[model samples]
Target: MSARLTQRQRALQKFIEILVNLKGQMCGLGIPLVAAFENIGKENTGGVWSDIFMQCSSIMKERNINAGEAWKKALENNKNIYLDECDYEQLWDFGERLGKSDRLNQEKVLELEKEKLTIMEKKAREVAETRGKLYRSLGALTGAAVVILLI
Candidate 1:
């Protein structure tokens, strides 16, 4: 498993991935969201997100990087194209909140899956134990018969 990321980075990554998928779908129809995010990237306010967005793009360019990079690229490309800083912040913030909630929901699902696995494992163990006792009893009976024949 990959190491965990900070809440902000995680949120940013989620937003990026969502937008990328949406953009990809739109691209098939020639209506990509790139222009809208680019406008957001162009804005200089809303903390250091502009720099973060650029970095995200660079990171995404690498073969091993994940959704975070794509998000960065989306923001970078959006600058001077679609959104201002305030707009970018609003979108980014919204995405961040959504990401966190999504993550939490997924975690709950995984936990339930694990619980099911544990239940299955316990059932398997019970079956094996029962089989083991039956085998042991059969072995003892066979040994007793062999001794009687020898006598």
Candidate 2:
């Protein structure tokens, strides 16, 4: 790794850090989704989560994470996961969905979580490698400049 980071690398590292924190907040605390969202602001470590929170619209503003007017707009803008796309509301129709058990719902949620993390990890690693190369080039340039100055 280089001694310094370019703007893009810094941004990617920050993103990965926040994503990992969000994952920990969900899995480590075992908090409900809504509860976790609400609690993100109070937690000092969830800056990325907090940024997403503000983007998602607060409950005070009558915005929902999944199915709502705000959600539709977010989807229109090509934003990430929303309830409208996931048909999360339909999951509540347990009568038709399954035989009176949340097992399927839990499995679906787990699968989604795993997918989310896997994608994030892949992106993070890619950015990290790219940034490492940029940093090496920059470090060599700086070293050459110093040698010329000293000579």
Q: Report the number of clashing residue pairs per model.
A: 8, 1
- TM accuracy, model 2: 0.43
The numbered model that scores best in lDDT is 2
Candidate 1 TM-score, true structure as reference: 0.28
Candidate 2: pairs in clash: 66-83
* TM-score, one value per model: 0.28, 0.43
- lDDT string, candidate 1, 24-129, tens digits: 3333343322333333346554234554444444544454444434654456555643233544554543333222234445344334433543454454445446
* Candidate 2 local lDDT, residue 88: 28
Report every candidate's CA lDDT. 0.44, 0.45
Candidate 2, superposed: residue stretches over 4 Å from native: 1-34, 54-107, 142-151
